[model samples]
Target: MRILALALAGAVLGATSALANGDALVIGNSRYTAVQTLFGAQRVAQAASALNAKGFDVTLVQDADAADMRRAFGEFAELLDDDGGPVVILLTGAFVHSAGGSYLLPVTGNGRIDEAEVLMQGFPLDAALAILSAHQGRAFLVLGETGEDPDLSLYLNAGLGELDIPHGVTVIRGPAMDVARYAARDMARTGRFVRRAAIEYELQIEGYAPQGQVIVRAGDVAPPRGAIDPPLPDPFANRAADDVAWRLAQEADSAEGYQTYLDGFPGGVHVNAARQRLSALNAEPFYRERRAEEDLELDRNDRRAIQRALTILGHDTRGIDGVFGDGTRGAIRRWQEETGLRVSSYLDRDQIARLQAQSTRRAAELEEEEKRQQAERARQERVFWRRVEDRGEEAGFREYLQKYPEGRFADEARAVLKAIDAQRAEQAVGQDRRDWTKATQANSVAAYNAYLRDWPNGGFREEAKQRISQLQLDADRVRNSIEASREEKAMNLNFVARQLTERRLEQLGMKPGKVDGQFDENTRAALRRFQDARGLRVSGYLDEQTMVRLLAGGIIGIDR
Candidate 1:
């Protein structure tokens, strides 16, 4: 079966009395709360009649939830004896497997199966194998697999996984339809070789397989006393009916169509194909809607355009990239909600056109509003500039420049301010030069201080301060002129340094006697006059301070 593997071994003797009283548990679950219904799963319950006819006691459960399945399994276990008879279990429904083991899902299980949930709530295949292992050669397990592969979580996988069959327990497995039909018709037939029936129905057999193994013996097991078998039907008529039902089911191609075929012919040959179709049809609820959108054959550019339109309509698509990810899907859902369409998060041709039209209208409105705003701003700027021009003051021009540096009349305002600044600067420069002249004529520290107070930022401010400092030093030197002269004599000026000093003093309009290195009376008078004019001590002797001022025009070397 699509569920698990089975291997048959050991032969059962025709005289075995244990076959007279076999115990069988049949569970068929089709209606599920979470996943697609296995339409033919419930038909496996029909196998109970066959098991009973073969002198076997059977317990049947259909569309069972977790609790019901557990109760049924418990009751079936209680009926078994340690060494009584053959044991059979027929399970039909959805199954999931993981690394741990396989489980038979109850009707209440969801699509997102977890390991703990499966282990706790679902019936473990291991439990079934354990029960069958006790009966050994006479044990039979028939699993009806749905053959549906669903998307489960990481810890679980849909469908029956590989089986770890216990020795001596025979397992018969195939698609739900094949297993169901085999269980109903061939599983309990007297003198029927189980392996031959498995091969005929294309079911897989695993564990305890032998050349010839029969689960039921004709002589050992008789139909219950007073139980009369029904008259056999015409084989030809049955085939004709089966063929007609299958053809009609194929033509309808719907869940109901295939279900009808299943109800009428549970053991029909097309039962497997019909159940497969039914499972597929019920699996996808939005099949038609998804197909309609896909038929549009949207390319990347088309998807991007749709995203842009959705964004313009105030739906945040997260990005304008061509890929339609979760954000884009959410945006589509919102748009569909507003537009009174199915909230499938997918687009049909008409819906796309409507979205485009709405976005176009919105864009036009925004453009008009923007243009009106621009016109209003331009009007405000003109009004402000007119006020500034009327004032015609430097402060007004500056204020206008601060407000709108790139306004239309900004250049004209700048030019006018530049000319006005130039005129004021010329007047200020004239006053500054007159003040400097007065300060020099006075030639005192107080005069330089007055000049600084008037023009703190004047161009000659640094020079004025320096002269004031030099004058103060000269006054201090005059008070100690003898000691100052003694310091100068100690300098021991050479002929070249003395000659350079005399020449520098003459160049300053203070005529020394000659360019010779001797300090004559003419040289002394020139030195005293130069010192008096330049704010230096006027001792009429070549002191260190006087020599420094005299040689200010160039470099000089002296020994001290």
Candidate 2:
């Protein structure tokens, strides 16, 4: 167990402390009547001697009774008041666990260990833990043989296990479990390693076997990991952020030191006091600037503007009020540091002008950037317009304007629409001319009206309208004269037919409706009846075929 303990000791996770103020409370109670002698007194006395050799303030109690154990815990809690250091607890004895309560068996028992009387004389583990937890420090509880009691769930449930993170308490049953647990979280996170031979040599002094059945309940952050060799101290441990923060907060020195301290340990120990001193140191430069500015007739609002400007440049001036404070001075120094200017807290006239010039320069740069973007946009628009023009379609032109207005083909599309309209106008003019000439030749009122209606806006519309008006007035008289001419001709024909055609009609045994010579409506009807009887061409006029058929019928036809 001694060998295992030392082996585990070599790989302590938070082994940074010198433990200068560390107290070792080693208790060993072997003189028990109701239980087996656990030989715990010999083991823990050895552990106490080892701790004393390592410079720990050893508090040993061998074969302690119930009263003595209680007094030891009280002194332990008191000793922790002055120094917030590591507290090592070594317990080797018979432990009682019943009704979910844990206790350490005392040597001065009057009855059997199982009885309530003897149990009342034992020390409560929970009470000791409560007192220990009151102080702000690290605790390492090293337990001896368990016999059968597993009531160490008190420490297990307190987030104590193999994880290397800080905890209220850590339980180390033996050296193997302690070292193995440390090797897992630490080795997996950081790949630094230690030699196995060194660990074996360190732990061999305690006469422990190489047993490793360590159960770990390292909460949510722990991943399933294979075993790994223990590691040496981290190479960059001294320069770690926590270490630097701890150091800077502890020692507040120059103005820069305090500023650095605040940067590193904003919520660390003694940080509030460090910041207060830093604020005072920073005020020196701010006052100097204020007095100089006042003498130079500068308004206090200028400092406020400068603070705002510094804030824009990512420097934290804390606030933008006119009274420039330590925070503002520190921000000024930071701006100077970043800008490659001479590092100082005080701002002179030239320095303020240079700092203020950055804003002007940035504005000009942004304006130039915007103009460059506009030019690029126009260039892209031209390229897209050219591609759309290659398609040679109105739809492509319309779609292109949706993306890039006033495209290269926009003017050409207007020209195409104008050309189509002009060509259609010329074709309409030609069609109107042809229709008007046809109406003039026909000399009919209906044809002229049709031309006027179909081509209301046509090229010959005026002439068509005038001709239809004049032709309509004479149309009735012309129709009447034509009817008279047709009646006179029919009278002459009737006189001839009456002289020669009536007797032929009587011979054909067909009524010629009065046997009149004129081809009147009744005579025409009789001719149709006679033609039908003879299978001759039917006619209501004295056509050549009717004349031939009449002659063939042995009738004297009109020779004229």
Candidate 3:
């Protein structure tokens, strides 16, 4: 009886070793150091237990930092053997993406995830895809997205963006809660058809998944006699030929070269790497120009110099803050187009030097032109003063002062005009002086009209007519301003739109105070300045035309 019990123990231990079938890595991050915590992300840890039950080696981490996540990936990679089997990786947390690729972010970074941080710290989805590609038909990646849309900096966006899936890896993605439930219950179940489960859960499945594909089988089932299962082609069968072709392709390092290799050996071991390089080469049309600019390794001061040069050349880089954002890129593209160069929106070393030289030349030319204009203006002022001095009339002196208020003979011109006005006043009658004084004191259209009626052809007749004209114009302007205010109110812009308007005004250097969606005196002044600059109606209110120009196209529906 003791020998039989020992034999049973040995059999159990042997079966347990034989059942080890695959490797799995599950990382679920819920708490964050900077941004809002993703509440349901940590629940995805249940998937680790489910995968372990299916005879899979699982490594699970929760709320992992960058170093912790990297170590987990390395450990998981070491578990993979040459013999292909099922491979599963599940990641649930904040995600940010750019044109390059999607990234699974760790919980320890700042809220504003820039492109540099993403490349250095974030776990690239493409790297996971590359690893999965080696296993072909037996690879799976499940992504659970926390629907928190934090503001990622310039080139990054919040969410799992569009993916470039490899040839034979399957990807399943959904919201964090739904993905957690699906991963534990259906995805880890033995003998479950992944496609049917995905359909039932309403999850999005992408890349290479055929019908009836199962990750784990129920048990070993023998086939009937003479019924043969088709064998998958071995990835390393023609290693010598594949190696030579891959070497030639890498040496060429062109899209066409990679394409030739792919066409020759579709199932080769280096196929995944070749496809990744090919995709990157083809994705950006100006990849060479962009790479050339990046190779310069420009510092902040260098970027600011480029912006100053662009602005001096009248390209309007928006601001010279040393950040090459969309405005700077657009300015660069425009400058390149005008200078008869490639409009790639990226500047090489030679281009930067040329821009600096052109700006320096332009600055000198502008200075010289300004000096010439100043000399010419002085000569014209002298000639006009000579003509006015020869005439010596009140009208001539007034016209001379109107044209050049600070001319060389301005004090002489004003003295002579004042004396002429006093002599005219002395020549007028006592009652005429009294009536003109009354009209001037009242400073109204009716009062001026009364003064004109009392004394026709009086000394102040011209002055009274001018005053009436200005008063009438002022009345008309007041009516128009009131109508404009009503029109602005009718639009009924919401609080968020108001905030956006204020923010845009601030961006344009109008100095709208606070930007709290409250239209105060400062905000109105800013709106007026914006309107005045743009040649719109300067009523200190937002009309359709003002809104269009201020927002730089049209009123956008801002999310609250």
Candidate 4:
């Protein structure tokens, strides 16, 4: 029921399915009511899908009894059609060991025979494999279990421990090298998955090449002509098969060394593939081996793992190498002390697994913390802008310029400033217009002084000066126009006396007119008449005090 998102194109699927492959048979059993098969059933289906896709007419029989399994095996073996290639038998069920070699069990019912009765209840694993291998074509037997013997150590110690099988049987084990395993491990290993068992086998076979290649087998058919080449020193042809096997065996060091061997044997059958693997090997950092007598000190990979773990726990260890010499040990000890685990320099399997898991947990925690911090910074920025705006547009704009001179929103701030400036300028112009009218209507010199105090750089300075000059001229004309009235006569006589002699003008009641703002003879006669009325010598020109009196609302009533 696991949904796998495989990004392989249908074209690849179509191309793989069109390949002419030989016969293949797959057997799977999970409802045995014995040991719960976690991934066994799934693996069987996966195998079947992979084969089918690889242009193989794969026959997948699941949960079969003893009779059914034997019958299917017989039928598959009888297929002698020279169609595409060789016949392949892929069995993924339980293998039981007895005094008579190994046996493939049925779905239910024990394959065990008691002392009272002896019966061949189940098909023998070795016989089944042997029967398929005996054919005049290439054969393969893939299995996961090595042996389930508790005393495996004693057998290994005797140096006589090998579960023998056919020579061409290529075996793959564990929840490794496949998509689900790689994904669960976060290894990013496999890029795709083969849907059919035949295709899976093909891929396994073709994966032995440099580029990724998969092949599947269906029914018994003749193998393709160019598929099985004459064995030689062709590196490209065999690279995938060799690399996958090497990787599975955890012989990365040996595989890397093969790069040198391939380099030496350039004309070998697998030369191209060897060179490719060689290039890959050369790029990888050299991993040196330690002598048996050496101390149980940490290595680079160990240190890297530790560093990665420490980094997760908020300690920024630069790298993770297995070397727990001092820094890594110190970090581990610190983490152990914090987490209440045993504080030790040496890391056991459980400890290492814990460390790796902790590292991942710590990474997620760090990422979350960073996101929170960013959110806080953004909030603070918003608060700052709001506070500035509260101060008023001018202050806000000034603050913005100071804070972010080349900010993305600089243009927006400038626009706000420009609007405020324009508004202030418009208000200043309106006030200046009103001040100009008020200053013109005022008759006193104090009013003009007040207007000048209020508007230092008002726009109506020239207009106000002109209006004041005209008011002075009109006042002088009014005094000159009156010839018979006693006050007018006295004013004219005083004006004349002030105009004629400056000393006499001060003695007289009337002051002299200012020579400014007057051009006609009538203005001169008016000044002369005013001087005569005040009983002083006549002069048309006004004195400094007289001009001050004319300009500053100093009009006086004189005795006739």
lDDT, each prediction: 0.67, 0.48, 0.68, 0.42
Better of 2 and 4 by lDDT: 2
Candidate 3 TM-score to native: 0.37
lDDT of 3: 0.68
lDDT, candidate 4, 1-560, per-residue tens? 11111111000011131344456666654324322122322344455445544444455555556666766676666653455354555554445554445555555544233311212655566665566555433454544331121222211221111345555443332211132222122211122322233233222332112233222323322244354553233233344444343222222323455565554555543344344334433543321211110123333334444554564565433222222333555666677787787665445556667877876665566446545764675465567667767776566665665454333355777787667655654656777767756766775566666677788666544334444554565566456444223332222233322333333333333333453333246555555544333233334444322332232221221111
Q: Compute the lDDT of residue 384 as modeled in candidate 1.
A: 87
- Estimate, for each residue in 1-560, the C-alpha lDDT of model 2 and write its tens digit: 01111110111112222224456666665425322122211234345544543335556554566776766666655554345545566665556555535567676534234446334766766665555454433555554432322223432221112322133554444232222223222211211222232243121112111233111112212232235633335554554665455344323334677577667667744364455445544644443443334334333346555764565455656544333445677888899898887666657788788877874465455446545765776587678767766776545554553433233455765465446445544666666767866887898878878887887777555445545544653464356436544532432232444545666766665566665566567666565555443344444444333333443333442322
Backbone atom clashes (below 3 Å) for every candidate: 15, 12, 0, 84
Worst 10 residues of 3 by lDDT: 1-10
Q: Write the per-residue lDDT of candidate 1 for residues 1-560, one digit (tens) a residue.
A: 00110101000111111226678777776535432333333245347656665656666666556777787788788777554568899888778898888888776535444556667888888989999988888898889776444447778887788989998998888667567767767887888998899867657898888977888877657443332644333334446667567656744545788899999999876665566557656776754555466557564447657866786677766544444555678999999999888898878899999998987777666446545765786688789888988888776777776555445687997798778655654656788878988998999999999999999987556557656766875676566567656655644444655776687778767888788988787877787766655445666676644543333333333211
Cα lDDT of model 3 by residue, 244-299, tens digit:
68657754556798799999999975676567557656865776776577557564
Count of clashes in candidate 3: 0
Q: 188, model 2: CA deviation in Å?
A: 25
lDDT of 4 at 35: 21
- Scored against the true structure, residue 454 in model 2 reaches a CA lDDT of 89
After superposition, candidate 1 runs with Cα above 4 Å error: 1-19, 31-42, 109-113, 223-560
Number of the top-ranking candidate, with TM-score as the measure:
1
Error of 4 at 553 (Å): 99
